[model samples]
Target: MTSFITPCDSLADVRSAIDQIDAMLVDLLAERGRYVREAARFKRNQAEVAAPDRVKQVIDKALAHALESGAEPEVVEAVYRSMVAAFIQIESRQHQALQARQAPDAGTMSGCICA
Candidate 1:
């Protein structure tokens, strides 16, 4: 279960709470990465993978969410920026590999008779 701002009695309690949140974060990030990789399949090239405008939109949305959730905008922006950058790189590489893998197959059926 997700926890909110709960008062801790000692450092151990605080550490435990943070550990739980970290675990949740790791799971969520992995799920997000899966979607990011899937997104590579839809992209045609590295430029589409990067999509700077989409990056700005995502960060803007994150900032808005931070403000609504009472989180520090700067901190949220910083984390999101780093996360988005890393995802972009991942997507770019995935896109290149996808293109390379498809390139060889795209011409393989050229000599086949189409009934």
Candidate 2:
């Protein structure tokens, strides 16, 4: 990762930093995706994947952290909302797949057996 304090005089330098930061963000998102998949194993149903209370809690935390980090709360909220939405979709798919594997002939189960 590039140092945040590194000075940039030219457009290319700024672009380089942005590219590096974007790469890091991709890596972090991938890691987060893995955790979301793991969490799917613990989720009981589709409602759990779209847990509203948990979403609010996460957004609130992200807002506070954004303020502390000198970033716009609105921007942080938007980004988190998008990320959470995507993760919820992923989790839902993973949950369905796991459920299908657990009960192939039983249609669908209501709750997670692993829970």
Candidate 3:
């Protein structure tokens, strides 16, 4: 039902390969967010909301990995910076919803600063 193909052997082939890879990355990202949502239920306090420092640390590590892997540092940084920002927003929202459900009377539980 499926077959394996090697990397692009020409410019057009390379473009096509890149497109396919991008699609796979999109799917993986969706799966990653699903897990993020599950983790959302555990963030009881608002302090655990956004955590810019943690995001920065993650971005730094991602950039380092990108460089070490011979990927374009600027491109990697840009992509991850945006990606992390978006995820943080999603995480914060999900955390808030969870906390509200778990503690309806409590006003904003405490944790890390949101981004």
Query: Could you give me the TM-score of model 2 versus the true structure?
Result: 0.86
Q: Taking the tens digit of each residue's C-alpha lDDT, what string does model 2 give over 13-51?
A: 999999989999999999999999999999888998889
Candidate 1: give its CA RMSD in angstroms. Answer: 3.9
CA-lDDT, candidates in order: 0.90, 0.90, 0.81
Candidate 2 shows a clash count of 0
Q: Once superposed on the true structure, which residue ranges of model 3 sit more than 4 Å away at CA?
A: 1-11, 105-115
Instruction: Enumerate clash totals for all models, in the order shown.
Output: 0, 0, 6
lDDT of 3 by residue, 1-115 (tens): 2346686679999889889899999999999899877877777665675777877898899888887777789999999888888887888889988766677455555774888
Cand. 1 Cα-lDDT:
0.90
Model 1 lDDT per residue over 4-105, tens place: 778999999999999999999999999999999999999877888989999999999999888788889999999999999999888888888988887767
Write down the TM-score of every candidate. Answer: 0.86, 0.86, 0.75
In candidate 1 the C-alpha lDDT for residue 114 amounts to 89
In angstroms, how far off is 14's CA in candidate 2? 0.3
